[model samples]
Target: MLIFVLQTLAEILAGGTSLTSTKQIDFGHPIDRREEATEPILNVYVYDLRESKQLQHSGRQFERNKTGSMQTANVSWPPTWIDVSLLLTAWDKTTLGEHHLLAEALTILLRHRSLREEFLVPELRGHGNLSMTVAIEPAIEISSLWSALTIPLRAALFLTVTVPFEAQTVPKSLVWDRIVSIRNKCLPGSDVMTITKRVAIAGIVKNAVTNLPLTDTTISVVGTEITALSSEEGLFFIEDLHFGNYVVRIDCPNYLPQTVNFLVESQTYVIKEVLLTPV
Candidate 1:
């Protein structure tokens, strides 16, 4: 279960497009006393898109047939419901947000370079789990998920797996963080002039441990009324300033003071990349 959860998350985060929900029957209905019994086969596949409400992938089918009289047809009943939502809920969305985690993971697992496609077969087990035997490279990591027998199979079938990004990361707030100065150089055999220009300086405070991007770092140009705040991208841009030497500073409650000296020239824009060191 853990491997499957991680596999799905990894696939989604890697931008995979296809998703599959599969099931297998280990023991089909027994041969009826009065008639020949038939086995059942089922596989459901769904495709994801950039927009919500994606379509299901076509060409997959499920089939089941009854063979004997009602009395003779009595056989072991296969589990009909399987809920995959709980495992999906535990995924780390911050790393794979906006990516199709299931599909990519399947692709990685399906790729067995040494084995031919005919030899490498993947079949879902009776418990809604996938199993494959092929000559391939094993994944770098594999987690064994503990199985739970909470809900009955039929009731569990309705639960959907959703990894919401909002729940994984803290919401970012607006903040002003840094000050930058752009300067123009007009030099000749005569005199050199230094002018002060203001540029944008802003970046989010990210946790070194979790690497989650932070927002609301205070940014300002010293001795000036100009100020700006970092956006969700941890970027802050300042506009309209004379070119010259300027000190760009970033101040946040938990992080250390981060500053840079930059000179902007002419109509060109200057960009500074700041990584806030964790205190």
Candidate 2:
């Protein structure tokens, strides 16, 4: 997977900018890529690769698909952002010539926002445009990198690209679906009184015109404590509802609030077509 990502990066550099049809571009250590004499070439060294600390991630997500008698749950992790830092050094014999090559490379890369889809390999096509930033400020100190390579530092362009690393699904068996609770209380020398009975209500909220599921919608039973927030697929479940009439309220951003009255006569009630109109 790493190999595919790196190969695609090289393709992006050569295809998108002035470096098109240029075979002088190479990857790996800069010193090894330099010719013995003054033949100019650009070497791309991957100095750092780490998970981006900026992109926030939500909690884990799980989806279930039922097949005949078997039900399985698949855990889908969020796509991770891998920040790759590349050190672009121009290899030449003379200082003046090396500066010229570096300037050409930097000129071709400056003001670029993202890696285009045309240059993307098959694996990277649908992952969205790879965001990139190029500047003189290397992610790591140039002197330190040159010291490790046992060579002197030269002018280089630091390029950072954001790559999304997607994870595979892990399947597991589905557990029990429903659970109910009952509570009983007795007063001093008095008859036993039932406090509450477990009842459930579930439904999906959608756009009235588009008929598309609305995520992050809030569903609640008015005048009661039972409530639930809609999932990504617009499904909401309010558990432990009382066996009586309910005024359910649905609220979402940029959408008008809605209220519906329903009487629950059974343990489970599934409401349908709970649509909300947009403002």
For candidate 2, lDDT tens digit of each residue in 134-244?
Answer: 888877776787788776766778888887788776554332234432121111454432223122566678889887778899887898776788866676666544355
- Report, for every candidate in turn, its global Cα lDDT versus the true structure: 0.35, 0.69
Model 2, total clashes:
0
| lDDT over C-alpha atoms for residue 106 of model 1 | 37
Error of 2 at 80 (Å): 0.7
Score every model by TM-score: 0.26, 0.53
Candidate 1 CA-lDDT value: 0.35
Top model number, TM-score: 2
Tens-digit per-residue lDDT, 1-279, candidate 1: 323333443333233323332222111221221122122211111211121132222232233333331111112322222223221111122324213333343344355312222332232222332223222221111122111223222110111232211112211211222334322221235343232333323234454555555467667877678777765545566555444566878776777778867564433454555667668
Candidate 1 deviant stretches above 4 angstroms: 1-212
User: Which candidate leads in lDDT?
Assistant: 2
Q: Give the TM-score comparing model 2 with the true structure, all chains together.
A: 0.53
Looking at model 2, residue 111 earns an lDDT score of 39
